[model samples]
Target: MTTVPTSAPQRATAPPSEGGHRRRRSRRTRERPNWVAGLTSVVWLAIVIVPIYWIVITSFKTQSNYYAENPFAPPGEPTIANYRLVIESDFPQYFLNSVIATIGAVIPAVLVSFMAAYAIVRGRRSRLLRWTNSLFLMGLAIPLQATVIPIYLIIIQLGLYDTLLALILPSIAFAIPLSVLVLSNFIRDVPKELFDSMRIDGATERGMLWRLAFPLTRPAVVTVTVYNALQIWNGFLLPLILTQSPDKRTLPLALWSFQGQYSINVPAVLASVVLTTLPILILYVVGRRQLLSGLTVGFGK
Candidate 1:
């Protein structure tokens, strides 16, 4: 009984090895459920879901029923006629045009942006590159609406007026600046030691760029690509001004068909909208992981 008493003294005070146990107790005391944060998240979620809910539910409604019935109510009689009407119109042609223009613009813009970003980060000593980067930064300040007339005149001068090429060219020009800015910052976050290691291994700059930098920065690449595609796909002004003929119209322009001289086909228009959003929704889902990762790339260790 006397010999067993020695363990009692040690149990009264926690051993140094039990610091983790103390920390766990302290953490439990500190942590609490944040009611304010939970409330704000629920509010924001409702704000976003309501509009999408209205659009999807209304798309299944008939034009007359959309106005006569409660705006927020589920369709009294859900019908696919609105969808059928949108499809009967030249929906496929407009969708194809949007695809053509978005693809045409994004591919070249991303390629150029990536290479320039790599160069800007790696060639910081070059004065010319510095100036070029500044020029790209300036492009961001120039709004698309501000240059509408100038772009129109230039497109006419280049004889690309009323063509998908007209839309593609301007979209590329507008996209490059922002894309370069995002990508260059991501490139800078790359470790200098990796670059030096690759150099010491007798790799050329091109090899290092493709093999090392490209793979490492894939999330950024996907982020910029998806963003640029969304912008170009939803572009209204460019398609509106650049193309005159109905044949050259894009998916955004397809909405114009639902607007008559006297009245609007609200349900049919919403149906067209639903169809138009599918591609973008698919794209977002596919790249969502990359997008979130890219956005938070250099936030902290």
Candidate 2:
């Protein structure tokens, strides 16, 4: 007997509906420009930019024009006299002092912090290391103001007062806590497989650290270096309290010297401020991408 030909069963399909289209339209509406956010950004930008612009314009104006002209007005006849005066003064010496202090502090702080972070991350199983990490975290809560008195007394006792070393030493101490915190977090994000692979290849921990950790953590290194450099460069209070001589004055204190008892030279003072800030601005511009990357993203295998 001939059997009837068998046929495959047809699968059922839902009828096309407007639900997905409607959902997409709703999402599109929600994704439209947030006017509130845009307006807030514009307002904040104006507030920041206006003052910087004012400082620039004010620095170029002559003293007579500075007062004669409106505070916000552009300089009708700009002169370099303010900058010339700043240069003629001991600005170069103060600049050198700032440079010395910044370099002295940042190098030691970064080196110590890097080693500390490496130890903390690699030796997390050790209770001593764990406690040390806690100690660093506690450091973040201690304000500089609270410790200034003790620091002053210590500096005096050690004969470090009125010296650039005084400024450099304290800056390193303060910079280490934040540097360690940042670097340890970055180190922890490194993949465990890489460490294991290195170990299998007969690489010692120190070798792995030099070959692996340093290369991998470059962005974090740049970030902390620029950050600590900026802090030490612009530092005013430490130099003010710890130093005693005009010859030892940093840029911040030199700016203070521009103020006279009777009248303040606004243009000259702003010029010095601009000059002092330029180096920091240049440093940030150079390392900005790496700094931003280290802060925002983590490394992986």
Candidate 3:
């Protein structure tokens, strides 16, 4: 009877699977939809796209149709008469002026900014360089609008007033700070070993600049050029104050004049806008990738 009193065997139970439970929870959280952010993005996208749609559609419509039809509707019968009118109304002259000012200012500004940035990064130990960099940064802190009166005085004194040079000079000043700031940081991102190796191989400072640094940071250079070109192209106040002659007027000035003259012809004004926007849009499309890379140089890299 005592020998028959054996205890029953117990079944081995599995331990709690905490990791799998946690993973399931994480999956659920990851898969969860963000309604608020999605909704906000859609709202903002519409806000931007709606105006662009209206402008493009309106540009193709006749003035009578523009006023008579729904503002956002596609043209019933699109016409190029508005474009022809804008082109014939001295658009090419203003466009050429913009091209000249943009090219003149951007080239020098980029070259100077590139060298200045290289100096600032490569000569960090030099007190003079430090001071110069500080001065350039200080320039950025001062708003361009605030300096309009002083810039006007300087342009007038230099006899650059009523000339494309008037636009070019001030644009160079404004463009340099941001270009240098972006470029110096981009240069700083270059591997120190590569620089040292280049130096060891008998490369001089100038050699290293053009051969090594320039190639690596060329994206950034393109970025600044496109960005500055865009800014100078669209600049209004500078052209308004700096030049008085219609012959020296840039695209922004041309657009303003379009508004004044075609106040009643809404489609014609929009047509002029579309034509004026084409170059900038093309420039942007060409350099968009390089521009993005250049502008975002040191961030999260």
Name the better of 2 and 3 by lDDT.
Answer: 3
Model 3, 181-277: lDDT tens digits are: 9899889989989889999999999999999999999988998889899898899999999999899999999999999999999889989899889
**Model 2, global lDDT:** 0.90
lDDT value for model 1: 0.91
Candidate 3 residue runs with Cα over 4 Å from true position: 1-24, 295-300
Give the TM-score comparing model 3 with the true structure, all chains together: 0.91
- TM-scores of all predicted structures: 0.88, 0.90, 0.91
What is the descending TM-score order? Answer: 3, 2, 1
> What lDDT is reached at residue 262 by model 1?
14
Error of 2 at 181 (Å): 0.6
In model 1, the worst 10-residue window by lDDT is 1-10
Question: RMSD per prediction, one decimal?
Answer: 3.9, 3.7, 3.3
Please, what are the lDDT tens digits per residue for candidate 1 over residues 1-301? Answer: 3654444444466465678889988898679677889999999999999999999999999878987999999998999998898888888999999999999999999999999999999975888999999999999999999999999999999999999999999999999999999999888988999999999999999998999999999999999999999999999999999999988999987777655521467888888889999999999999899998988877866
**TM-score top scorer:** 3
Clash pairs, candidate 3, are: none
User: For model 2, what is the alpha-carbon lDDT of residue 20?
Assistant: 80
